[model samples]
Target: MFEQSKKYFSYILNPMELLRTKKVLQVNPTVASPRAEPEEIKIFVFDYNAAQADVRELKTVPECFAFLDSPKTTWLNVDGLRKVDVEKICAHYGIHYLITEDILSIGQRPKMDEIDGLVFCLLNMMYFNEKDSAVEIEQISIVLGKNFVISFQEDAAKDVFNPLRDRLKISGSKVRQNGADYLFYSLIDMIVDNYFVVMEKLGEKIEGLEEDIVRNANTRTLAKINMLRKEMIVLKRSIAPVRELVNGILRSDSDLIEERTEKYFKDVYDHILQANELAENYRDMMMNLNDLYLSNVNLKMNEVMKVMAVVTCLLAPATVIGGIFGMNFENMKWLHTNTTFIIAAFAMIGIPLIMIRIFRKRGWF
Candidate 1:
C-alpha cells in the first residue's frame, strides 16, 4: 500500500523527472512575448485627429504623459508587462491597483469594469496554431480615458490591430475623424474581427479532419479529434464572455464613451454575438467529429468480425465429417471404398461453394 501511494504521487514529488519523461505536444511555435527589459517596456503612442496623425515609439512610460490630456485623440499601446512601469503608468491615470493587477496578469476572463475615473475592458486574444491544430491565447486590457485609449497587451510580438493602425494613417477615415471613444470602439472591433479569422482557420481544420476520419480513422486520428475538442473549448471560453462585455459597454454610463460611440460599440456587440454563436457551432461540430470517429471505428471492427464468422461457417461441414471418421473402431458409412474419399472431398468443396452462392444472392458479404 505504501509503495502504491508513492507511485501515484511520484510525479508531483519529482517534477524534474516528470518534465523529462512527459510527451510534449509538437506544433508550429506560437509568437511569444519576450520578457520585458529590466530598464524599459515597449510603448507606442498614436496621437491622431481629423487633420493628421502622429505615430511614434517612446522609450519610457512617462512619455505617454504628454498625450494624456491632448485635444487630439491618443492611443497608447504597451507591450510586455513590467510591474513597476505598469504601476506607475496606471497610477498616473488614476487606475485602481486591483485593475492594474488584472491588467498585468495574463489569462483573465473577458470583462468590463468602471474604475476610478476610467472605464476598463479586458479581452483574450486568440491565435490558432495550424501545424498542431491548437489554440494559443494572449490577454489584452484596454483603458478608455478622457482623451486617450491605452491598450495593454501580453505579447509585444504580434496582435490583430495592424489594420486598425493602417486606418489611423488614412486622412479622412472615421477613425481619423472621431474622438477617443471612436478609437476605443475601433480597437474593440478589430479584436472581435480577429475571432472570425481564428474561427475561419478552425473551420478549415474541421473540413480536413472530417475528410481524414471518413477516409480512414486511426489512433492518430483519435488524438487529433481530442486536440480539436480542447481547442474548441478554449475558443469558446475566450469568446463567449466578450458578448456580455460588449453589452455592458453599450449599457455603461461612462462619459468617456461618447453618445455617438455607442452605435459603434453596438456593432461590436453584434459581431461578438455572431462570434459566440460560431464558437458554439464549432463546439457542436467537434462533438459530431468525435461521434464520427467512434462510429467509423466500430464499423471497421464489425467488418473484421463478419469475415471471421463467414470463414468459420464455411469450414464447419468439413470439420464435422473429418472428426466423425477419425473416431476409433468406427463402422462409418462409405468409409470402406476409395470412391468414398473422393465423394467426401466433393461434398466438402461443393457445400462451401453453395453456401457462397447463397450468401452472394442474399448480399450478405
Candidate 2:
C-alpha cells in the first residue's frame, strides 16, 4: 500500500527545484542555415463570410497573386521565414525587404510602421506556465493592405492565433463578418489575451517565491527568484517596444487600420500598461527577497559570533591562571609550594564562575 501511495504521489508532484536549472539558451539567428528549396511561402486565407474562398496555403507566386486578385479580405499567414521562398513570395506581393528582414530576425522589437500602401506591425506572442516555470517568445509581423492582411510568424512550431482561428470558424464572430482590419484586431486581441495568461502565471510565481523565501531561505529559492527577475526584465524590454508601437498605431491615421478598431487597440495599450506595472512590482519584490536573505544570513552569523565571544570571555581567566601555574619558577615560594597547583586551579575555576554569576545577575546571557 505504501509503495502504491508513493507512486501516486510521484505522479502528482513536480520537482520545481530541478526545473530551476533548465536553462534554454536562446539561439542566434545570424548564423541560421540558408534554404536550398525554391522559394515558396505558405499562406492560409480564411473566408468565413463569403463563398469559401481560397483558404489554401500558397506555394507559388501565381497562387499568391490569385488569392490577392479578388476584392476579398485575404489573410496571408506565412510560416518559416528562414526560406528564400518566403522572400520571393513577399517580393511578389510587393512587401518591403526591410519588413521581410524584420520577419526573419529572431529578436525584433515590437513596433509599427506605416508607409504608402501598407501598415506594418511587429509584435511578440508569449506563453508562460507557472507549473512548469517555462516561457516561450515568438515574433509576429503583420502587414495590412487595402483589401488584405499578411502575417509572418517567426517559426512554424507554435502559435497563439489558434484561438482566434477557432473564433473565426464560428459563424457569428466579428472576425468572420467584418473586414481584414477586424481580423487584424482579433489576432492582436488574442495575443494580448495570452499575455494576460502569462502575466497571471508570473504573478503566481512571484507569490510562491515570496512564500519560499520568508519560510525557508535556500539557494534554490534565491536562484529561482533571480531567474524569474531576469525573465521579467526580458519580458519588460520586449513589452516596452510593443507598447510604444501600439501607441503609435493608436495615434496614427492609417488607412489600413480603421478608426473603429482604435478603441480595441487602446485596450491593448492598457493591457500593456498593466503588465508593465505588474512586472515592476515583481522585480521590486524579488529585490526585497534578496535583501531579506542576506540580512538573515548576517543575523545568523552574528548570533554564532556572539556565542563564541561569550564562551571565550568565560574561559579567558582560566586559561591565564593555567599558564601561570604551568610556569617553572624555582625562586618563587608560591610556585615551589605543593599547594600552588591546587590554589591556581581553584582560582582558575572560581573566577569564571564568579564572572558568569555576575553576567547572569546582569542578564547578559
Worst 10 residues of 2 by lDDT: 17-26
Q: Write the per-residue lDDT of candidate 2 for residues 263-347, one digit (tens) a residue.
A: 8889888887887777677678778878887877677779889889889998999888878766787676687778888888888
Per-residue lDDT of 1-365 in model 1, one digit per residue for the tens?
A: 98677645765765643442232222222333234444457999899888999999998778887786798888999987788888988988888998897887645678999887688999988788776566777889999988888898867666988988999999989889888888888888888898899999999999999999999999778767766777777788789999989998888988888797788888888899899888888989998999999999999999999999999999998988778776675677767878978877888899999999999999999
Candidate 1 clash pair list: none
Estimate the overall C-alpha local distance difference test score of candidate 2. 0.72
> Residue 172, candidate 1: how far off, in angstroms?
1.1
What TM-score should be assigned to candidate 2? Answer: 0.78
Tell me the spans in candidate 2 whose CA falls farther than 4 Å from its real position: 1-42, 50-62, 129-134, 215-222, 331-365
lDDT (0 to 1) per candidate: 0.83, 0.72
Leading candidate by lDDT: 1
